[model samples]
Target: MPPQLVLASGGGWGAAPKMENGQPVPGEFVVPNGVPVGSVAYFQVGNPNPSYVITTVTWDGGTDIKGYMSGTPTSAPAKKQEVLTGVAKNQTSYTFVVKAEAKNYTVRADVQYANGAKGWVTVEFASVRPTTTLAVPEDKVGFQATGDTNTHNVAGLVQAIFFQATATTHQHGGSFIFMQLVKSARVESAYFENNKLVKEYIENDRSIPNGEDFDGKLHDDFLNRLAYLHIYDGNIMYGWHLMPGRSMPVPAAPPGGTPDPPMMFDDPKSQVPLDWIGNAFTSSFSTYLMYKPQSGVWVALNQIDWSVSQAATRTGPGGTWEALTLPAPTQVSQPSTPNGMAAFPTWVNFTSNFINDQLNPWRPLD
Candidate 1:
């Protein structure tokens, strides 16, 4: 009978090569295709026969990996892969590096017993290429994150770029007063396995104080807004960054806080609405102030009427529409209402009466 084969190398994960369909075949290992071009995968095989010699190891997809970059490998590798004719079977293995065009591959090693018997072992591994629709460089294959709530998710497919990403503006509508206003925020983006975010990505991005998001936007105007969840001292904190290393005005509880409820940005409340996304339109309301707070309300109300008359007209799908109730402003502005927007609430207290009653109410996903 052939001797047993054992694996003892790092960077490899798979069942030992076994008899499949009555032939020696290596077990399969799955790896993301979105990996660094030169990333190395290592594997070793142990021979049960103490008196045997490994003859050869061959990698099919590695003909050009040897000296493609940085010149040739300096000395013989500690692990034997090629030219193993006289090498002891116990102390040898094979290693291969990823290339730009890598794909499914297998390695085979030939061995000979002291008594002139011949046998062989085979191992296999696979590469799961990135989604070509959102292709990213292989080297950028690490956990990445981006989003705040007023914007979109930031991501990269080509660079380890250090670009500015900001959300720091709260003009009128939205209730993220404390969440906006991040200046000089730098973010790096890379592809992770899938949308399934893990603690590794969270903690890694948080430590750097910079990162990117889904659409590949890495500029100072990076505006992907996502309800953020963080990890601190082994606790998951649900909240957003007002700036670098700070929390949003009204932060959320961490994981396990509500038994079985997933974070807002992750599950049921994942789809944030556009109308509910941006800050309120407060131009008319600001102009109302010129009429005095008491008159400001009336002036603002009237301005709506005037605007309704001149513009901002729309026809519903069912051929329905509503007329402007208040008069349009003659000199200044008014506060935003269900019909029109004029002013920005000085601050946002999402749970306060002002927000729930007067200011934009459809905000801060529950």
Candidate 2:
């Protein structure tokens, strides 16, 4: 009788492993009919007659972090054994089971017979990459543009802020002014991000819960990074932030000090002056801003006007950040809110919006 080595029970006709509604069934073995024609979690190899009672099976874990092979099984519900050698050779089919991680495998399996003849097979577990849901960036259900009209999405936000009641309307500085400036700022360049990176970012962030995918949230949220642009008019500036889909955090008192240009370059953190941006009591130079998510608060990194001199250490302790250029920002009185945060019409939101104009000796104002 001819010795045989073939996949026995994968995603085939006879038997199949359990499956979740939308999820692919795990542990699919190989089958003779050749549909999938490959093995996933398990395989079988036996002699046509008694001459070759497939004795042992060995495999390389490959991408799998770790795995183990159990004793041979001739019947249903194969019992776990320390080694395949102890199993009876008279059985018709010898089954080798493998449990792996990450779904894709390039395992190489070797089979040995009682007669010492050896044969091996290489198989791959090509399964679909699982898709998951993510949190939505926009509040479609309860976000109102003003007091009456409801709004969502970027375009809606642009229009809302564009026509939004002037600075004092929201009882704060002009969100509209900043909005208009950004619109005219000329998108010198923007951050490049894809859904994958955004998804990874969302997943890594504890604040963001697991949800759905392929929707607009991932794309929208990433756009909120607000760190991608270089603008110029009379001054050379590099800035970022649209302020469309983000929370409002009270900006810190504008950075107040003298304009010692050399002072800002002292600390690597302060090397690029936030005061130069918009971190000012009032300013004719670049404005700078920072965001701290842990406390859910935004801080104006360096608060300074042109009159104030540059010191050092602009950005507070946190993660990476970005910036954008803005015209001189006017301060508005914050309302008497219980939480001291967002009580005023602050020009900058709680974002890592950085602006580099005269401050950046590297890219000085044009």
Candidate 3:
């Protein structure tokens, strides 16, 4: 077989690598996650024949593209087409600094063997959207949320009920919120006795805050619109920085009672207790600002379903969790709604309407 081409990494964007018939292959060239402008795309040369040597590499077919090798400039700055030819030795990898545009970019390489055989391989990196950096909000708790709604049936139902409501008060939507309120929140690689975490080392900490909230008009649209769902799944909270020396807010110890010991990694055999998973770890709330549209008379419906799981890692936030010993669905009160409803009725309150209002000003429903 000839030398194979595969993507080593995708600037944390739309790069997918898969296997074909038990062999590695780059499948589905379309980048679904989207490569933002000014992000790097890394590709690898896999399983090359010992005799085959890469003579030249080229990148083209995008609004702006640049080529780099081992962190060194290989092409003339930013150009429509970039070519790096006459490589001194074998290149195991190549890099491309890409710009967001509407078109696709193609990466090609020319290979030659000592025995006079020549071959070439081409891989296309496509799709680009304007870049938006979400400065993860730092908080005592590790929870960031976003919500959306649909209210097409409100108009007809209001005529039957003979009542009026705000343009957004009658909409139906849901918000997914989860908090790592416990200290030393970590996801285990496997399950163990007494539902303990098997892994000891913390791969990543959600306590550290980094990055910035959406600054430009492009990012503003992303917060309220484009990447709303993406943020929920992107685990934006991992980059959040907590207060100095504090991972999360610990509850007050009972009178004359000692606080729980800090989670330790020195002992591998010591099973870490599940107390690290705090209450209301993750919630999928189906809310009705004004529900019962079929009856013409609408009432607030804020039903929030909560669960906890071992899969709740620092890198990935929203997903179905396990019950373990706790009840499958714990009943918890709904916080202030977007419309200022306290305990189901409030005359004045508007600030704490969003689940993530503490971290971000952009509400998903707005």
Candidate 4:
């Protein structure tokens, strides 16, 4: 009786998990039927029929396929193909490593049974590279209070300071920026909130609830060690209330100093620096932003003017505020990643201080 060939272990069938940076990324084992380029997939074959003894196995691939018979699967294959002979009489199984280098690959295995009976099987899969979609950097434009051609505006503020807004008009106020990456059937959406990460999803695995943080745990493998956001030629401010008549509580006059003047809602001097956001204040104004998403650590080029609005309010300071960047809207560049990870230009991490050009040093500029 002839032996029936079957997959013994590892990623079976069409999915070939590749070795990335000498390591296997999680969720690669479950990818339906495709392989990411520059990755290696291991396949073990078993002989179901005891009557036939598996003696030798040979692997062949297309020009771009790097195939191996022995060694670690965590690294790329050294050569194009491999052949192994002398499989002790009744060897149960044999494993082969194949690296995807191009768009398509057809890996064929010629199995030699101890009886000299020859049989072969071929597995075809595609090598796909993930596409990264990054939002273009633009100027944060326009500010409209309630009943002024805008929605409630709270969500806008939240969108600005946290999530990546889909529309260009909604891009303001965000604390972090990101790009969506899709590879094969997997769609990865990751970001940082409060400089911390929470969850990640793989290949239509959308179990994570909405309005939740999507921080990819495999960020280091895809992005550079450092990323930067450039804020230049504009202004940013924070205030207590979004309404017309907001004011902060005034203390009594000092021993010899008169009490500070009241902060009028319309006064340009009414606002303060961005430190009003609490603990994140120092980190926010400095070159080093308080974020480290799985993608990478982020730095900033803060050339914007900063101010804060008065503390007093008509409604309890409920994340509401009257703030604006005017005359010239604050222009912000998108967060940067390595060219190898995504298609992006080299980012210059320096800023002009009106005196000269300087690489925004890694310290607080507030």
Task: Estimate every model's Cα lDDT from 0 to 1.
Answer: 0.25, 0.24, 0.28, 0.28
lDDT of 1 by residue, 139-257 (tens): 32221222323122111111111111112212111111111111111111112234532111110012121221211111111122221232333455432223222222223478534
Give me the displacement of residue 67 in model 3, in angstroms. 9.7
In model 4, what is the error at residue 209, expressed in angstroms? 53
- Candidate 1 residue 275 C-alpha distance from true site, Å: 54
What TM-score, over all chains together, does every model reach? 0.26, 0.22, 0.26, 0.27
Model 2, C-alpha of 268: deviation from truth (Å): 40
* lDDT of each residue in 1-366, candidate 2, tens digit only: 223444444322223333458563433333222221111233445464577666776655332211122111111111111111232223333332222111344445566778877765544443221111111113321122333321211111211111111111111111111110110111111121442111101111111113211111111011232221222223322222223232222233458432211111000012222212112111122222222111011222222121111111113323123232222123211211111121111221111122222211121112
> Across residues 5-101, which tens digit of lDDT does each residue of candidate 3 receive?
6654554443444346866463224454444333455666554655665554443333222322111111111111122233322355666444323
Backbone clash tally (model 1)? 46
Best TM-score among the predictions, by candidate number: 4
Q: Lowest summed lDDT over 10 consecutive residues: which window, candidate 4?
A: 279-288
Query: Per-residue alpha-carbon lDDT of model 4 for 1-366, expressed as tens digits?
Result: 323435422322334343569784432322344543323344445564775676876655523222322222122222122222232222334433323122565655667787777766555666433222223223322222222222222222321222111111111111222211111122111223466432222321122233221222111111221222222212221111111121122223557443322111111112222222211110011111211111111212111212222122112223444433221113323443232222211121111111111211112212
Q: Model 3 segments beyond 4 Å from truth?
A: 13-32, 51-92, 130-366
> How many clashes does the backbone of model 2 have?
43
TM-score of model 2 vs. true structure:
0.22
Q: Would you give me the overall lDDT of model 2?
A: 0.24
